[model samples]
Target: MITPLIHYIQEHATFPLSETDISLLEEAFIPKKLRKRQFLLQEGEVCKYIAFIVKGATRQYTVDEKGYEHVLNLCIENWWTSDRESFHKETPSIYNIDAWEETELLLLPKANGYYERVNIIPAFNEMRIKLDDNQHMAVQKRLNMAQNYTADYRYEELTKLYPEFLQRFPQHIIASYLGITKETLSRIRHQHLKKAS
Candidate 1:
């Protein structure tokens, strides 16, 4: 469906799409719905489609040898999610992505023919939008920030970047992303609140 995806493109695309471009997108993208906790991707599966969220949320995570889940990212409406390495390399994914709520998504298949056809449409150049490189850079930037800044600084930066994240995600997951223990995060949050009050 060209519904939410089109709106997302209009909001975020660097270039404008024409009627023919929309038609091409409609033909290429497949729509799907998932119930809460349903997995869009599982560890060890090849990710064939990059999904754009239309509604609800999803989390990408990995379980360690000790079985502790480490959150890599959370995707809400208008966000894109996929294991880029798996998708591009046609290899197994090490991460899992599951719906945090009942979700709607538009899936873009990763095939040369599909890409070629879509690239023929305006504002659809893969070269201009390198998803994998962007994703890697984002993760790297977050890691660098975590290493160099105090927890308070990192938390504030995250809040500025994703305003709804604190309200939407659990504290433990947020703590994990900040590379802190839950108790440490609690102390930081409490201290911040005390100062605000």
Candidate 2:
């Protein structure tokens, strides 16, 4: 479980982590497991931790007044999920995060100076900076796709970039993530199959 996170840190860190740095990480990250459909954070709760997925899948979403869930993000193994505003500013989150499958996570909590201790490591600090930049770019691209691109184009890009999502998630979830109706997603998939055949 921890090995995956250790590997991720090693891969991302600009410098090699010392033994002490590894020990700090081990101490800081608390391992947690979630059953399928279990909520990690619910709407109106302050998000106290940032979770790194070790295995399984999770989705971050919001419910409308009519109780329809609008998917904001779909995350899987090696992905990080949190409401940044809620976590950093200690505010209530409008979004909910839940596990789509039985999941393992390493949680970095806001309490006890754990985050501060970990960030003090030069290699970890560098990795965090890099991750923030990548996350920013991904958010910008996703916003562009949502605001400007056609649904078909968005679906195509999703297929190209994260084909595993098609296999791992249900059609309704995929449709929600794409901001399309399930019927429209079915139609688009059928059309693609026709073109392929």
Candidate 3:
């Protein structure tokens, strides 16, 4: 399980972790499981771990001052999750991470101190930078899309972003992630389906 993870990271951005590097990572990580709705981190608590999901799904969201819930993101198998601000600065989190289904995860601390001993492959640093850059770009796009795109375009882009979501996640969750009410999502889906037919 861990081997493919290390290999995938190495191949994607040139992390180039040798067998030893991979093994060291495996040694430090702890595996944990959560039943549905279990929380890995909660609002106002310091987020200490960056988790890699090996199975099931999780959602990161927050309740605003008006009591409206805003969906931040959903993570499935082979994805990593945490509040980036909290993870990076070691501060209290503003978001909550809850499992949508029963989940299994591998976790490493943000300041694990393992990176200091294991060589920082230049490629690995680049990979981390690229991930952060891409996430920032995506968030910016999402904010603009919410304000500017029609419900139809938003739905289209939602499919483009998470093509597997319709089949994998529950519909209401998908609607929430798309920043729409379930009825709005239903209307958009109906329109799309009618056009396809």
Top-lDDT candidate index: 2
Q: Local distance difference test, per candidate?
A: 0.84, 0.94, 0.80
Which digits, one per residue and each the tens of the lDDT, describe model 2 over residues 52-156? Answer: 999999999999999899999999999999999999999999999999999999999999999889889988888889999999999899999999999999999
- Candidate 1, residues 1-197, lDDT tens digits: the string is 56877776666557788888888889888899999999999999999988889988999999999998898888898788898789889999999999988999988888756656876655666433765577779989988997899888888888789878888788998888777789988998898899899
Model 3 segments more than 4 A misplaced: 65-67, 115-123
RMSD of 3: 2.1
Which candidate gets the maximum TM-score versus the true structure? 2
Task: Name the 10 consecutive residues with the lowest summed lDDT in model 2.
Answer: 1-10
Residue 96 displacement (Å), model 2: 0.5
Tell me how far the alpha carbon of residue 149 in candidate 3 is from the true structure, in angstroms, after superposition: 0.9
Clashing pairs in 2: none
Which segments of candidate 1 are over 4 A away from where they belong?
A: 126-137
lDDT (C-alpha) at residue 57 in model 3: 92
The alpha-carbon deviation from the true structure for residue 45 of candidate 1, after best TM-score superposition, in angstroms, is: 0.3
